[model samples]
Target: MRVTLYLRCRGIAPGTVDLVSTGLKTDHRGILVFTLPDNHPETLRLGTNDLTALNPEGRVPILLLPDGRKMTQSGPIIDLIESTLAPDDDITLLPTDPWIRAEVQRIMWIIAADTQPYQNIPFIIQAMGEWGMVKDNPTRHPLRLHFIRREFGAIENLLTRCAGKFAVGDSVTLADCFLVPQIRNALLAEIDLPSEFPILSTVWNNLLDVPAIRAVLDDAGGIVQPLVYDAEQFEVYNG
Candidate 1:
């Protein structure tokens, strides 16, 4: 069966999440990946474009399934992929042990729920301009760092207990798919992973060597460049 994955640049969290998740599985060889260039005409038209019909949120990483169904949101999309795999599949993103599975989800949620949303570019713009939050004019605002640091601190502590090589164990799991991208975001935000969160830093460093993670990073263009939001341009699409 063929699957179509709609993604944006690696800088975007959801895209990176799906990219890493799909790359990890050997059964996904038939998947076709399409990446929208940053600020492309099609991308600028997201909210009103044909794409909006597929996902009203106007987000990337929409997985078009073979049966003419589409799925969105990184967590659910990853879960769907995991669900389809054979129980004895040599490559699994989730562990079979119930308690270990819970640990994986715990770390994944720390990044997915507590961290990424608060640091999203549009949210940062609205927080500062519309909500009257204090503005620190960095590529990623201080407000973004506030959430990143807070959640990453929690992840770091948890890693000290559950982590072996990856986020949960020596094998790569769903948590690592959520993790490596957030660490990329934190690094882009100028967080010193090694100094502030050493365990997470080690996990991030170790993941870099994994073939699947490396493939996603290579496809995503090595290190992520800081996102630059043009207010006038944003208005054209979001208005």
Candidate 2:
């Protein structure tokens, strides 16, 4: 069954990249479907806070299956993809080895829960706005950079122990899927790539060699590949 992915053009929702990349590596059937970026005037008119059962949280990174079921949120969607879509073979994005699997989950938690939430564009926008700041405010951008830097620093230390060619091993795993898009976001925020964290840079560069990962990056027009992004269309909402 072919799946349809609803993802934003920016790397703001790194989980979408993780889900799509995992599906690709496991040979799970799927297709790309871009969502209207959150900043669109029409999206604003729809009311940012109004989320439905089909789109709980009013978020992207939704996966629609051929059977008409919609999958929302990054973590649950990733879990679904791994358990249901991945073949019971060597190429699975989730590590089969028990210890390695645990390590992968550890890295994933750091990225998904610790790192992503702080800098999530919508969440930051909402939270900052509540405090009397608005989108494009000078203070909001610095606040995002602060959390991103701290999270990346923690990941850098963790990578020193678990990383090989990738975050958990020589192969691309869920951890890499989570980390790559975060790194891309960091790049757009002017977080000096490769220079700040050499190990992560190596892993990010290596992972892009995978066709599935590359294709998603191209489709999303993430920071790493500026050529794929439309100049006028993609505005960095978070920064």
Q: What RMSD, rounded to one decimal, does every model reach?
A: 9.4, 10.1
Q: Which stretches of candidate 2 lie over 4 Å from their true place?
A: 1-53, 65-69, 133-140, 225-239
State each model's CA lDDT, in order.
Answer: 0.65, 0.60
Report the C-alpha lDDT of model 2 over 1-239, residue by residue, as the tens digit: 01121122112235433343211110111112234445544335565423343375544666666566778767677677555533546566667789889998888788778877787554455554456554553223777788888888888888899999888778777787778777877776678768888888888888778666676677666545232123222233223
Q: Global lDDT for candidate 2?
A: 0.60
Question: What's the number of clashes in each of the models?
Answer: 0, 0
Tens-digit per-residue lDDT, 1-239, candidate 1:
00111122112235333332221111121112233444544445553334456666656567666565779888787667656545543555678899999999898888878888888766665565557777654346777888999998998889888999988989877788778777777877878888999998889888887765776666655645344355454444334
Candidate 2: residue 84 lDDT (0-100): 54
Clash count in backbone of candidate 2: 0
Clashing pairs in 1: none
Clashing residue pairs in candidate 2 are none
Candidate 1 TM-score, C-alpha based: 0.75
